[model samples]
Target: MRMNAKDEAEMEYFGSTIRLQNENVTLRDTVQALNAALSARDDELANIEDELSDRENEVTRCERALELRVAQFNQEAEELVQQKEDHRRLKLECKKLQNQNKIE
Candidate 1:
């Protein structure tokens, strides 16, 4: 039996409502997936920041060690120069004693 226009119009309205509900569900799921991907990206950025901080700390430590080494080298160089001057004075005194002994 063929239905009248009124019945067909009601069925078409329900069909349109179901399609709208499905569209809303698909949009909600897409939004959730985007949020998850954004969270993962944020975590990766944090890890990179942590790695950079570690590297900066290590560089600071290395610079301090290099400064200590340079200071030690300077101290040793100064001691060597003092020793050389002492040897020069001793050599002059020995020569004067030899001339005095020859005169006597």
Candidate 2:
């Protein structure tokens, strides 16, 4: 028995359609797998970003602490210099008074 020409054409078209459908299914699966991997990578990226933000805040705090310490040191040094100058002036006054008394 031979297939009619119209029936054979119909069968060929059906085969092509089935093959296209299979190819579409494979492409869909590949896309789904890629999406899953991308989602996992996105989670990792978020974690890394959070860690970097935390480090940046910590650095800022340390910088502030260092600035405060530097300011304190400067103030202390100024106070020490003033005290030394005052001591020198008092000694000079005392020596002048002794010299005047000795001349009399």
Candidate 3:
């Protein structure tokens, strides 16, 4: 069976229409896949940002704690110095009294 010129033309037009439709479907699927990938990456970025923020907060807490400890150590060192000075003066006074008693 031979296809007349008009029938051949109609068949070609339908074939072209089907090809165009398939291409459109493929393009739509590609766009959907890209959108899903972008959404996933956005979620991952948000999670990473949250983790970074948590670490920053922890560092701040540690710094504050260290500062308090350093202040406490400084106060203790000052007290120790004052106590030593007092002890030295007491010893000098005791020695002087002992010498005067011996002379008497």
Candidate 4:
């Protein structure tokens, strides 16, 4: 049995339609996979940014604490110097009184 021209044209059209449908399905799958990958990367980037911000805040807190400690140490050092000066003056005054008593 031989196919008529009309039948041949119909068969060709059907095959072309099937091929286009398959290609469309493949393209859709590829687009979905790409979108999923992009979404995952975006989420990862956001997490990294959050971690960086937290570390920066911690660093700022530590710096402020260190500054306070330094100020405290400076104040203590100044007080120590004042105490030493006071002790030296008292020693000189006591020596002068002893010498005066001996001369009298």
Query: What overall lDDT goes with each candidate model?
Result: 0.93, 0.99, 0.98, 0.99
Query: Model 4, range 9-53, lDDT digits (tens) per residue?
Result: 999999999999999999999999999999999999999999999
Give the backbone clash total of model 3: 0
Give one clash count per candidate, in the order shown. Answer: 0, 0, 0, 0
Candidate 4, after superposition: displacement of residue 47 in Å? 1.1
The candidate 3 region of ten consecutive residues with least summed lDDT is: 85-94
Per-residue accuracy of model 1 over 1-104 as CA lDDT, tens digit each: 99999999998999999999999999999999999999999999999999999999999999999999999999999998998988898898989999899999
Q: Please list all clashing residue pairs in model 4, or write none if there are none.
A: none
- Candidate 1 Cα errors over 4 Å, as ranges: 1-9, 102-104
Deviating ranges (above 4 Å) for candidate 3: none
lDDT per residue (tens digit) for residues 1-104 in model 3: 99999999999999999999999999999999999999999999999999999999999999999999999999999999999999999899999999999999
Q: Model 1 compared with the native: what TM-score? A: 0.73
**Against the true structure, candidate 4 has what lDDT?**
0.99
What TM-score goes with each of the models? Answer: 0.73, 0.82, 0.82, 0.80
